[model samples]
Target chain A: MKDNIKKSYLLNIVGILSIYLILKLLIGGNVLNRYHISIVIFICINIILATSLNLATGFLGQLALGHAGFMAVGAYVSAITAVALKSSGLPDTLMLVISLLVAGIFSGIVGIAIGIPALRLRGDYLGIITLGFGEVIRVIINNMKSITGGAQGFTGIPRIANFDNVFWITIIVVGILYALTHSRQGRAIISIREDEIASEAVGIQTTKYKVLGFAIAAFFAGIGGGLYAHHLAFLDPKTFGFMKSVEILVIVVLGGMGSLTGSIIAAIILTILPEALREFANYRMLIYSFILVVMMIFRPQGIFGTKEFSLSSFLHKLRYNQIISPRKEIKGDE
Target chain B: MAILQTTELAIQFGGLRAVDNFNISINEHELVGLIGPNGAGKTTIFNMLTGVYRPTEGDIKLDGVSIVGKKPYEIVKQGAARTFQNIRLFKNLSVIDNIKIAYHNEMKYSTLEGIFRTKRYWKEEKKAHQESLDFLKIFDMQDYANTLAKNLPYGKQRKLEIARGLATNPKILMLDEPAAGMNPQETYELMDTIHFIRDKFNITILLIEHDMNLVMGICERIVVVDHGKIIAKGLPEEIKNNPDVIKVYLGE
Candidate 1:
């Protein structure tokens, strides 16, 4: 397995170099330098949000519109934690990592609390409940004058989150998610998604798995929120309101509900596409809505639609690299 | 001695009583059949036994222990397992996975062990998969280990559902309309499989079947019902000869 991975890694390096050259040429050096770092950062954050939501919407087949509420919980928790411990003067990297993890756990707990009752609902009822819950969370934050500062926003947050931190954490979280979705738990979630009744008959404990999926999604959304809070050094309840929830939902839908790579690609495109067309900034929201509508019409399942782009499939085409053909019959000499 | 007994087991659906004072006693190693015309509450009885619905009023005892008011999973843990009248295999999962899921209740590893993929978790998972494979091999379905349940042939899908039920390692396996969708050959094969499970696993079976031939061929005892009441209970030959059984069957 190691040898196979090594060979694949070598090939991937070559592949990545070619793609980088192509991207560099298409958009000139100066523009790429200025926008590339931020675009990558946005892509990472959107991937976290999309993939996490997939755990609920795609795997568990629950449509939750309040993911941003969980994200807000994480962001605020992490922001408060960082600020409270500011006097201790912890290292920035360590503080950032700890804050993100704390945020994830906090959001996961809130997720479990919300999911228990909310997931009992089915179809559009679940959607409505989640939407209402999202608004409720925002209102609570807006009213909490002492802790959340009542709409003035939480400022002076430590700016420990940068492109590198965002990139690595996103990679790790996505990697963990990929592993989970392929595991037995992942299969069980997918099974529940396909048919909850059959899943229960097969002794799946469907509600437990559904709640588990929701908690996981919320955990990462929180982490993503923590990343967001630290990146901007400021946050408000409005930042993680219903429209923000819709923004993340757009990412999940446009990327294909079950397609991780599609989500990542969609994230990058959605983030940068607007700024590239900056002259039409007034119509930015309009363009975003239009793109989603067009994509829905053309390919409702999104770009990949639950299938991943396999480098192995591509490498199989270069069969000239193999010493022995896979199809060849090797028998004892006659 | 009877491993499972139901006394006056009944279910009421709105204005109508679906099952009225239905009683059954299944001894260890017996293959029993419950037959009735449509809407006669044969499936309703199975549902009651499986805890999908609580009995309107009756005592269901497994080994003399009352299982009344217990949940479906609670009944399952008490040495009873069942298949749905319509096959309810976990569709998106692999054939092996469908069976392994039934073994989830038997797992000894904690969630912490599962998350870290600890040694205990690996051992339990390995054993679970092995047991699932062994169960599938009984139905000659080990080759389709990776095939999704929905992708299997109809006959194999039915067999997979039974395998999943068997994976629970129940003392009594209840199959609802097991031969509902099969041709004669498949039905015959299923009959053999039912006997194989009974003899090999030393488990009793209470089956609700629509096919008279398959039911009569394997069931040591038969209970016939009509309009939610037992019309006759005896050996197959006696059930076949009973006047009321004939009237209920032929709609006389």
Candidate 2:
């Protein structure tokens, strides 16, 4: 069993790395144009945002609407750090790494600060509180004229987040989140989502897991923000407003809350959908709204529900005969 | 020695005393039942003992150690675990995962260990998987280990709840309406399982049950309550004959 687990982990890492390499090769060979590369990078950033939000909303069962606030925090902080380090003649990769880490940690700290008190509220109450917090964050950024450049936007952030960098970082973020939710701690978080009272009764420190989930989610959102800042070479408080948070939430809900794969899939589709429909550019928002409304009416639990797509499970199913396997019967029970 | 004891435990929601002057003493390996009519504060008493409600007044001790004012998970760590009146399994999770989650406090691997899949993580995870599976086997649910908890039949869900409670390795297990929705056959099997666990685990059991037959058949001693106060306490036969218990609880 241990060997099997180890093998699966290795397989997953290899699978992701190969995909990264393939994308890198395509881009380097100029098979993918610059416009497509930009879209791919945007998709990666959205993936990170959606997965992180999914941790809070999907796994922890907490509706958090201040995700973009954390992202803004990450974006500004990392961009500032990268800009400062650029003058120091540090390696670009090193500067980028430090900036992302700083952004993630700072955002995580903020997440804890907010999450501790905010988690006390549930459902829509929590949502409203987080939404207020996001606005508050944006307002703070807006007023900090010297540091954040006010409504004019913070500029001159180096474009360090190319397709390769953002793609790899997204994989790492997704991997960490996946590892967490699959562990004992992750199970505890999920249990809280299932039933908080029961989770406490069964010896899970509900508050601790709740905070952990929120903090981790915030950390990744921050990373996404940092990547966005570097990719776009700009930062605006307006970009991290409540609408941005809602956009991420929409991705999570559309992807299936508890499934990481669902988030990835939804992020890709949502990011590219507007650009792909460039011919009807004027109607993009309408199209997006229509799809969301239709999706909510038809598959409210999201596309994947809480079930994740597992490569090992898929392979195991293929290896065994459907007619002879008890596993098949077990799957049928679901 | 008593494994769990509550004295002068009381709670008031505004002016109404939800559970006033409630008391219970459960000895090691004893199967006890708390039976009361609807809204008789039976579940409220369980709530107080499990730290869901801080008593407006009173003391609760486990092994002579005061556990009053501790958190619910803290109380469980001190060797008490419970099932809810409504079964509270992690519905989306698998049956084994449900039991494994109850073993959360028991897992010694740190967060870093889990993330890195350290040697300790692998060893502990394998052990947890085996232990959870063994626990499911006790209820003849080993085959359903991979099945989602919500997909399980109602009777099995209840059984799984108990299984999960036991996985916490509590010295005293508090069950709320274990037989509430069970058919007679399931209830009968539950009774056997309860007996088996008490003997096998050498743990005291405190059960809140609405079914008189179930309570009377298994519980060596029964505590009957009405209006948040104990009206009668004695052996099952004595409780059955007690006029106050019959009037308040049996509605005779």
Candidate 3:
């Protein structure tokens, strides 16, 4: 069993590295146009946002509708910091890293602040509280014209986030999240989702884990927001409204809440589906809504349910179960 | 010395007094049973002891320290663990994971260590896994370690709930109703398991059960209650013969 675990880890690393190399080669060879590159970047950002929200909503069993609020917080803070540091003779890369960190921490702190009071309620009450909080964030951003540029949207932000930078960052964020959900702390959060009363009876501080999960989800959402601000070189409070939060939630729900791979796959498909159907631009949202309704009616647990896709496990099942094994006389091949 | 002691424990729900003036003292390694009819406030007393519902008035002490108003998790940390009457297992999680969740307070690794899979993290996790498997072995549930809790047979689910509670290494293990849905054969087997656990762990047990046969079979001392008050307290033989107990069970 231990050997199998090690082999799977090695295989996953190799798989990811190969995919990254292939993408890099395609972009370098000019096989993909600028529009395609931008879309890939958007997919990466969406993956980060969806996976983070999955931690809170899917794993923790808490419904939060203000995720884009955290994203907006990260965007505005990072954008302001970047603008302030641009003329301070700092390296662009260093400034970008600092700004993203600021964005993540700021949003994480806000998550905790909201989670404290919001998590006191459960089910639809919690969802409604988070929704209100999201709107409150937008209103705050709108009124703070000095820093956020009010209704005009914050501008003059540096564009440092590219395909390469975001790709690596997204990998890091997703990797950390995956590791978290598989760890002891992650188990505590999952138990809360399974049965909150039983979780408490088993010596788990349900409130603490709930707040921690919410804060971490907000942290990553903020990071994605920072990347967005840099990529667009502009920010609009209107863009991070309730509907934006709904879009991220839609990706998470469609991907299967507790499955990171599901989020990633759903993020890619949902991001590109509209672009692929651009001829029906006027009915873009209508088409998207129709797909979502159909998906819910058929598979309410999302595409993957709570199961993760493992390449090693799939290969093992195929080789051992489906294919008949020959006489085991040549077993020393390894 | 008494491992658990409750005095003047009471809780009121608006105009209703759910449990009033409930008092009990359990010594170390004692197998005590609390039995009463439905709505007799038996579970309410259990709730107060486990910190699910704070008593409107009274003091509960574990090893002589008052635990009143403490959170359920805090109470567990103070060496008290409990199983619910309705079999509250982590239904979606594996049986082994359910046991591991109980060992949360005992795990020493931090979140950072867990995220990075540091050496300490791997070591602690391996230890926890082995310990959990050993627990399953005691219940003869090692084979079902990977099975989801909800998929287990009714008897096994009850047994798993007890095993999960025992994983906390509590000084006092409170069981709300271990045989509520079990067959007679399963109930008989549960009697032996409860006795074995009490001897093996040397922990105090306070169980709330409705099955008189199971209660009489295992509990060394039994307390009978009716209408939020203790009606009789003695050996199972004495309680079976007590006039007040007869009145409560037979309804005047």
Candidate with the greatest TM-score versus the true structure: 3
Candidate 1 local lDDT, A1-334, one digit each (tens): 3355456546645665575566557446465574576666667787899889887897688999998898898889899988887778898878998988899999999999999999998879999999998899889988988887779999899888876567668867775776566445766687788777666665567788889999999999999989888887888888888988888888888887776667777888888787777788799878877888899999998887765544544456466565332111111000
Range of the 10 consecutive residues with the lowest summed lDDT in candidate 3 chain B? B117-126
Model 2 docking category: medium
Full-model lDDT, candidate 2: 0.87
Scored by DockQ, the top model is 2
Model 2's i-RMS, to one decimal, reads 1.7
For each prediction in turn, the share of the native Cα contacts (below 8 Å between chains A and B) that it retains comes to 0.24, 0.82, 0.85
lDDT rank order: 3, 2, 1
Report residue B144 deviation for candidate 1 (angstroms): 2.6
TM per candidate comes to 0.88, 0.95, 0.96
| Model 3 ranges with Cα > 4 A deviation | A321-334
Fnat, model 1, is: 0.24
Ranking by DockQ: 2, 3, 1
Candidate 2 lands at a TM-score of: 0.95
Error of 1 at A318 (Å): 5.6
